[model samples]
Target chain A: MALDDPRATPPPDDPAAREADAARLIGDERLPCGRLVSHAWEQARAAGDQPDPHMDGCAFCRQAVEGLTALDSTTRTLWAERPSARTVADRVMRAVRAEVRLGRMLPLDDPTRELRIAETAAAKVLRRAADRVPGVRAASCRLTPAEGSTRVTIAMTLAVTLDRPLPGRAAEVRRAVAHAAEQELGLAVSTIDLRIASVLEPLKPTASDEPTLRDGSGR
Target chain B: MTAVRTASVERTAARAALAVPGVSELQPSLRQSLAEAATRVRRTLGSAAPSPETGIHAERAPRTGAWHVEVRCVLDEDRRALDTARDVRESVGSAVDAYATRHGIPGPVTVVVTVTRTTGHRPSHHPGTTAP
Candidate 1:
């Protein structure tokens, strides 16, 4: 539901009264809809701000928050269980400093001003666009901006189904990347060189993945 | 009634522009920054203060009392900087309106966003283990 939609939230008033009403509605399991729950949960997780009046006394929201809290705890426990690198921060800082050193700016949309885009941002845009194509994973992307246009070179590893042709998949990825660069960055791609680094086989399902139902029916 | 200064307009514009998701920060030009520094030094010396606008250029229409704002910023991480800048332009009007309402100033405001720089993670040249 839209945030401005009045039906999405209850009026802010006496919490005790609202809670009682929410309890009755929640007993029927129909108080908060999925959209409201998701929005409320995100707001709680991100900013811990409860501006929505319905969140104040809604039992469904309370239950959802409790489940999210439990999930957060479980995720934190899993995170703590993992082995961590002590030098990760130092390595990251070194990499960031290196990137700062190689900061090449690309031309932006503004004609009156000397605004430009970083080459890193352009590469990322191209890479993400190529990766979005089915069965294509972008391995690397390089962007070189000259006087008027940009040259984008991408290396992609493709995972193709046995039925699909290799050339078709590569062409699809190329078009997607070019279109994304044009649409997102307002960049004119003078050249896009796609290198197929590797071809991957699609994963086949195993027999053990079959559903185990008690009544001899898959349902 | 109190008067709203040009500095307040610039601050409001910068805040709204930075609030847009993808905008890394306000990127004031070197000339603008130098001018601001000069104004600061002059203020320290007890002279008539210059307008405190930086990063954004704001001009008021003489007859209409409408504010025209131009903002420069650095884009970060988000590839859709153009779209994000469009969103920032939409936000500026409301931000200026809120500021004006709070300060008892009047009327409609216009905003323009110019992206100065874009920054994101550098793509690795390695044949393997790059981000998928």
Candidate 2:
């Protein structure tokens, strides 16, 4: 039987006041719908809480609640799913702490925010400088901030022609690059570490090689 | 070929040295130490006055052959000034030796130890007098 049906049996009344109680129980205070849903909604709203309209009147809220309920039901239908309340609480607390730490490490409008930008610019400059140097073939540079100073370390492969004296010139180039970085960027150049990748060899002329032709005519 | 062999040897020697007793830490290279020294000196001079006898100063000298290490540390204990200096020298030397043996390099390790501050008692002032 539907709970709201007027024919539904009411709870047994006290025998001493059965006559008076029956009339009171049948009054407007006795809602047709089941008391469980109504009582829960009233209590939630009385505490200045938002009522889930699925349990009340609004269709949108009802639809949303019904969707969530359907999802839960589907999951349960597929498998027996149960999770401890403590585990959920712990996961939530850990997520909150991690977010707080992340927020502190990267606050908006921090002055140090420019440090990343400056480092990127400096890396580009170093790469350009290394490219200009005759012996350095391909170079990669890293700039790190350390204790009020910046350290730039470079790794590169040297050209075959410059391989013999690369080490000596490498130190000089590092110094020049570091000096340029400090003078131009106003950053304290702490150290410049250089690593040689590999030495390239020039192609040699061979008897089997054919001479190039201009306009399809052999020269 | 010889240069590659030498580099390998030096690396082996450096690793060996690190295993020695009283060795604290081994740096990948000496450039870090030099940079640290520069930082220490800048910080010391930019702040209040250091002690008279033991002010911030960096000394760099060649060790075995190619490697150089710089030490930048504070020294505040006034009574053990000599001990502190000796300890700094020994620690730096040991670290360099450790690195050289590990790398198998036979070069001297140059070490520069700087006493940034002397750890002694601060001068006491009169109870209620204000300096003019």
Candidate 3:
């Protein structure tokens, strides 16, 4: 009888029967026993025969493979817990290839690199100082490199208080910033533009507005 | 009569100036400092009292035929310090002009702006640390 025919004798104590039973219990859509084994074996052999272009181009895949090779003996024991080696390798390879392509397009060696870095640093310093000043609601500051020097500008909103004059207060803030920039950063700031964007009313009650409580208990 | 009224007006103008932006720490101590400076100047003059014709010494008068204004302020780093100073000058000058027109004063007003300090945030690389 032909091997494909049912009339052919099944292998003694057939492992295929157990595999079929397991597949059935798992509700697999594949056909039973011998055919399933043959199909799977053919696919594995076919995959092994094909060329993988990703193998050469992907750094992540290379790294993963290197990692797996380093854990060669341990990987065998962990094989079931881990995903299939081929699948893991393929995923890593695809990601690394994409990263490499993007990285190449955006080269990090521009001529304005130092200027941009300095401006960024100056902006950070201004932002911090603004946050510390009381009655300052919000602030934004920037430093840009011009032809020979730098220009710094600050915009801020203040909390309204009846106690002091607005113009004088704004002047004080401007002076403080100039001193800080010169002393701290050593930047030659040509201009410092301060704008009083808005003023908010103070929340606390003034001494004159507080009501006296009876029985020496100020309520 | 004009001298007494001008003195009162000058005091009012000084108080109004306290409302301007950049006047952070307005304490009695600062007011005392100004007062002490004025007193020292007066003491140095000694016996040279104001002549009857001038009414008040021209040097000590707050008004130069109109309103006289003085401002002390602090500014942020982001602000153009010189520009702000110029703006203050213009604003005060205009305000004085308007005051002169309404009050029928003939002299020009002078606004002196002294920038005491500068303050503001700077950009930084790290979130927590201040920029160097």
Q: Find the candidate with the highest TM-score and give its number.
A: 1
Number of the top-ranking candidate, with DockQ as the measure = 1
For candidate 1, the per-residue lDDT at A140 reads 68
Enumerate the candidates' DockQ scores in order. Answer: 0.10, 0.01, 0.01
Error (Å) of candidate 1 at residue A138 is 0.7
Instruction: Encode model 2's per-residue lDDT on B68-112: one tens digit a residue.
Output: 544333334322322443454555466556655665654665544
- Residue B59 in candidate 2, Cα distance off native in Å: 48
User: In CAPRI terms, where does candidate 2 land?
Assistant: incorrect
lDDT of 1 by residue, B12-121 (tens): 87778778888787765545654444344334434555543456877777678787787767776444666776667778778887887787676678776666556775
Compare candidates 1 and 2 on TM-score and give the better one.
1
| Model 3: how far residue B41 lies from native, Å | 77
List the candidate 1 regions with Cα displacement exceeding 4 Å: A1-102, A109-113, A149-163, A207-219, B1-13, B19-79, B86-132
| Per-model lDDT | 0.57, 0.38, 0.41
Docking class of 1: incorrect
Please rank every candidate by DockQ, starting with the best. Answer: 1, 2, 3
The segments of candidate 2 whose C-alpha lies over 4 angstroms from its true place after superposition are A1-116, A148-163, A202-219, B1-132
TM-score of chain A of 2: 0.35
Q: Give one digit per residue, the lDDT tens place, for model 2 in A89-110.
A: 5545554553332211111111
Q: Write the per-residue lDDT of candidate 1 for residues A54-134, one digit (tens) a residue.
A: 676676776666655544443334343332343344444554564464356665454422334556666667777776555
Q: What is the fnat value (0 to 1) for candidate 1?
A: 0.17
